[model samples]
Target: MALLDKLTSGSSTPPDTSGMSKQAKLVCELVADFNSNNLLTQIRNNNRSKSDIDKTYKYPDHFTSELIETKNFKMELLKWKNSHNPYVVLQFHGGGYVGAFKTQYRMFAGLYSELGKGASVLSIDYRVAPENPYPAALNDALYAYDWLLNHGYSENHIILAGDSAGGGLAMALCHYLTDRDRILPAGIVAMSPWTDLTASGSSYTENFEIDPLFGNTNESLIYNSVYPGNHDLTDPYISPLFGDFTGFPPMLIQVGSNEMLLSDSILVAEKAKSQGVKVRLSIYENMFHVFQMGMTLMPESKKAWVEVSKFLEQMMVL
Candidate 1:
């Protein structure tokens, strides 16, 4: 059951720099600088001034940023393209559930659209912690999903996907939908999903030195704190690894062998399999969290996208 010792056994290849537009390279550098300077942390800590902060930052293309109001709360939605039977992909972005914008995932939205054959993707900008506590983000995601269904999209045509925290949300949404007696989506894809908000997975220690995105246990604890309130982190709807996998749809999980969340994905896959849910897991060696974002430059990223596309095609035929 422990898959952590199985290394990728592959060589490290640089991302494809030739195909990258000058603007993209510039954006990557800027983001790298911002991350290095810990500006992202500053933004999250100062959530009270988000409006001014949002106005100062520039987002990438392929995502039209805007806000949507639901009965419970207001959240943002990132629209990729307009298409009939659009094969909608509801995306949740990763920022430890505290920071990160929809535009930061432009590469994913573009690749999903291209690989999914014109799928119109919408990345959810749910409420974050300290300001919005447990179930706030979950409620917003469910509301958006319901909006999509009401607007003519069938559950069978939708694909739930996300990276890091968003990946966890995808799994949580699946569990939530099933609980509501609603039809599940066509499929689900989680890239290094942070399934255990309690940070209780073994990889949190085993892969600590190997993971570059999250360096150590201390950092993981800080990220987990974003979720305010006394809710149980192990609640199946909160930490999907604890959720019932029975009656769930097919799933695809991709994670880096070096990520702290590696065990989280592995455990989810194991639980799904035990519950009779079809699951496919791809573990990329020497890769970091959400490494697929480098698809514009990384061969492995492209290959991962191809695998996801194949899974979606198979789900469509069912």
Candidate 2:
């Protein structure tokens, strides 16, 4: 209750961290060390060369990722061996539009498959920013969706999912499809989606200290500078917080109550609900930025996926 008060108070300060779980506390400490060591700065500085980052985050042997290359872009399909699942999940990995490493994306796909029992996830490695920039990633997402459709999956059988920038990208893709009269997916699941590139949300300042991953406004500034080029931040295709969700399918938006992007999820749900869209917003108590990444250890993270599975199951049947 205190956490909710802090979130809705619109105060640009963080709440007490005394109630955080042991795992969450450890993650907060680890991320603090990570930031103090300037690891994120190094990653952003490395640009398109992921060799160093790749070495740091490799997928386990159990996960299978098949490489798919197109003339224009590339993606990976992650699932169990000989999976016959008819449903598919097209996932966009989050790295502030600057990072889309396979390790993180593959892990997410693996978790989805495990949770859904048989569904497979296609993680799209779209062109990143400060190099390919906007529309490049968006176009690649659309292309990957088309590739899935061409491979025999129907629009209703597919689900769009992502975190952070990728979550924003997923929303943008829905808008793009809706605008072009293309068939939409059955549902969407976004984890801590950065819907507003402008960083206008009150949570940006309110939950700053509690959010372990995002330290300050500089991270957003760096991502915004490289991503948008000369485009306005308010453009719905870029910052989906302003997009039209009138024709959008049912969406499940999850965010940590302690993260700065909390407002992004709240407002997006409000906006979608206003348009008569089915939107379910889950705000986890005491969780931080993309805390679901702690699925291997955190109980809250595991609970989050359970909720996701329930949502997917309910939506896919409709």
Candidate 3:
């Protein structure tokens, strides 16, 4: 709590990188290395069965990871705790449609569940690209949303959220639902969303050097090919920056200043505001992509979690 307070309090100096300690840096680097080597290619291949893929990554304690087959596709769910009638927070894991799953985002689910206080956090593992492609993942998200609704969860008690690609999908799902006259969620949260499938954001170039995760242009190009092929990348459903924000539920967005996707979040916020949608955007200075993953270690990350929790609580009251 003290650490969170200190982080929330104003500080002039950039977070003391010197105090990061050798062990912490090594741990972060090791995680990054493991992700880059093993998981990156595995996700891109998209050849492994769902069970085989689940076996590859490590999940945190207390998370019940399981596969639930919906009507059209199979979706993986990561439940943080046992609950009856808990508010449902359905999260989509980020991988640019190629990388992460419930295991990689288990920590996020745990933090959200803890802060939400009696809420249930479920991270959805949708099909990836170069195989499943566009509309497949989007369809899976809609199916998951429908499943929640059919299982006795009310739309007013549900929150949709995700990071990176999953973040974009959350927005796209909302658009699709709204178009189909489905009930909107209570709220939405996106962490560093990649809103522009076209990769048209100026920050993509400006933040390239500072962003540790997506520094290489070729890697992004390769990823773009897998998901947005033959589709109009600028289509509102594909690039949410181009979507209609009218009549959507309240939204909270958090993005790191150093990420290549920074502009994507900014554009979405601006568009939402233009349409009079209630929106709150927090830009964390000097933080890397999805810095919230460092909540266990970094003060900034913990502060972000608290802010998101407060925002969701307020939305629930509306």
How high is the CA lDDT of each candidate model?
A: 0.69, 0.78, 0.72
- Tens-place lDDT per residue, model 3, 14-42, is 35432333544564465456446746646
Q: Give per-residue CA lDDT, model 1, range 82-137, as digits (tens).
A: 53435777777776666545444655665565556556676666777767877877
Off by over 4 Å in 2: 1-18, 43-64, 217-224
| Per-residue lDDT of 21 in model 1 | 45
Q: Which candidate is the best by lDDT?
A: 2
Regions of candidate 1 where Cα sits further than 4 Å from its true position: 1-83, 221-223
How many backbone collisions does model 1 have?
A: 2
The number of clashing residue pairs in each candidate reads: 2, 0, 0
RMSD of each: 7.6, 7.3, 4.8
174-237 per-residue lDDT for model 2 (tens digits): 9999999999999999999989988888887898766666756455442345788889989999
